[model samples]
Target: MDVDPAASAKVVGNMPPNISVCILSHNYAHFLRQAVESCLAQEPGDYRLEEIVVLDDGSTDRTLEVCAEFGSRIRVIPLPHRGFAATLTESVRHCRGDWVAFLDADDWFAPAKLRTASGYLRTGAMLVQHWEHVVDGDGSPLLPDPHPGGNTSTIIVDRAAALKLLPVTNEKFFHVLDDLGLGARMTHPLTFYRVHGDNMTDRATPGAHQEYMADVCGEIAVRLADLRITPPPWASRSALRRLTWHYRAEARAHEVEAALQRGRRRSAWGPLLRELASTVLAGRNYRDRGPSIHSVLTGRPCVRLAPSPQEEP
Candidate 1:
């Protein structure tokens, strides 16, 4: 990420006063400067950004050069790639502000991203995230999931409480849809989550990808089962339904992997079924006991039950 020094300095010097923005990147110098500029462009009113932390996970590109140009306005932490989970965990643990925000290396924020996020945070809820724009490699808008606006962007939580819930860090060995666990615990409309082709999940290698996803689902099952949070009647039923679907999903996943290994792309049923199963489980968020099938595939925001699980799924 070889950003022009003058532009980089301007962005860093303009950071607001109360919030802290954390950007995680790896060899994405081309996209790093834009992301930082976006953060710097945030409207700084009464709610401002106090700190900005950029974690460079072993970028072999000019990404570090661009970061260095920012001087002290941003804290640059460089380390080998520990994967997203560990890197994110370290970043959050080191955050000093009451409100923290996340930005991926390949993604950039909208100018109003933080301004809007901080406004919502004032509500005193555990979180407040909003929709995001899904873009193509060229940055064109693509189909947005969950809410039409995008993934939740401005989430304000009691940092301590949110952490206790085992919030999703970038390095946790999540397979696919790993963030669902943390999102499940919190209500909709939290941070603006960007979906791009080069995202971590999209980068998963062939043979290893399927297994990683299976691991994520299995871990969620075990974690939710033992969590202290109680599921409402609907949520309980939803969990059971998801549990059933997960079992079948895993089975189909194995078959898909086996078929792929044999160089036989074969039929679509296996992969299609796996996706259907994941879709079903995701729907559980809306129902009191089980998620409606309609909402699952459609990505509609379901009304959360009054007293259900508080911890991430």
Candidate 2:
């Protein structure tokens, strides 16, 4: 694949690519190559893979070197560490396709990912996504299919629809629950989500995670207001309260783990009890809920309710 930027641009303009794949990287030099390779290897079918854009958000590692190795096959943008949200916003500007697909630096897509998604996206769907194979840092399967439609790596968004959601100011919330925010519930197992010690989710403290969730919920509220649609009874005030309780429960669960790590079994009991109580309360509140505010606003069902290996009894 000759990746001359000039020639590629000419080809893109002449042929008009069906999908543009964008990969965002910070410091994951070790995983960047694999991500890029996977995108490059996508097979063409109903839609052609028009371009692959790699943005390095001021990584101190050898990430730029890895991207340079790909040469003209990908458009590599070296940027300062302006954070994920900013990087994503800027990356979209460089995409030149009708549909945009995102691959996290630490994740990779299946060979048929584009082929599978193009079929649905061409049908006028605003967004399309698929299931993900969750693996450890070493690439060994941890959960064969943890999330059927929740991973951003699995998503393919209509370029125009994506722009409408962009310039997402909340750095913590942007790209975190993008699938839900864009209503990409329809899915197929077509991507890999790597879990590792250095992952953002793992690095976030319980308190930080709670704060991020709160911000996400607040954003959801604002979107709902914009849509001028009142949430149903199931997704109203009580639903928001229950969602907050779940975040608190997650925090308590982490505290219990910390206590156990310190060999303080007795100390862990308090947080354990609190976690259990919050879980019970949240469960009761969520019992009869329909689609959540996120679902309602995005006009898609919640992916959390999707069946996957992890959800199997």
Candidate 3:
């Protein structure tokens, strides 16, 4: 969480901007405390930790007890498990902060997370996502390498800008929002992402998660076409089925590549060669503003900025 000393010059007043740490949880009571502690430990120094709210959606466990343990340090909103995107929307409405930092209950943040993110948000990037430390269920680092991509816990956005993409961003496209015609940017790693067995994306079943990701991208590509952009060629008639074919083919290649990452497979050349062919053969500029065909096919990073909930998912 090292802030470039030059970033300090942009600090307007002694008070920090209103930044809320929104913890989205279900039955992850065991890890919830660590997530809460991570936020409580932060000293915004400039505006305030305006609201640290937990959108607990239909947990049949001791999740309520954990919130009570905080003793008013944070607010707990009991929701009836509408889904991930819906709870996130509730977070936007319930929070009073000008900037919202989302934290998944299974993960936590570094001590300087808020302090560092606040500085970068001033750079006028409406949506900012930092890196994540991929960890095991027990809060231990799972890999030597870090995930320099996006995660729910890393999205810190300007409230007003997020409200614009409300209706367009539904359950199918909530977390997949990378380039939704918004000014999105990336920063350093500060959040921890836990790959527990019960995660939303299945990791153990090989191609399971990759297939899900492919579908997510296909749906996004269709929606991206509906936006005020030049729209890609794949957005023509029967786009979902057609685009999904490309997405699934690329996803299969990525699944093999990922297997190689864990040292479970040795046949990396096939997938790598196909990836090369796809990149070289496919025309660039899948609508120019980028969420590029290459980017999606290669598992590249993207942004997720939802303007509102009652609007999108």
- Cα-based lDDT for every prediction: 0.52, 0.62, 0.62
As a TM-score, model 3 comes out at: 0.67
TM-score winner: 3
Tens digit of lDDT per residue, candidate 1, span 1-313?
1123233222222333256788888887887887787777776654767678898888889998999877887888998887766666666676787656767767777676665554344432334345555555556544445333322123334344344335453222122222333221222322334444455663234344445545654554554444426542223545545654554444445445534533445442456456556646655422322322333333332332221112211
**Model 2 worst lDDT run, 10 consecutive residues:** 1-10
Arranged by TM-score, best first: 3, 2, 1
Residue by residue across 1-313, what tens digits does model 3's lDDT show? 3334345344344446688889999998998999999989995554468889999989989899999999889999999977776787778777888888888898898998877766656654556677777777776776676677466787787776555334322233433233332334445668888876677655444445554555554455455435425433312334333333344345445544454434444444455455444434333323432332343455542322221212211
Off by over 4 Å in 1: 1-18, 143-158, 167-197, 203-214, 221-313
Q: Would you give me the overall lDDT of model 1?
A: 0.52
Error of 3 at 174 (Å): 7.6
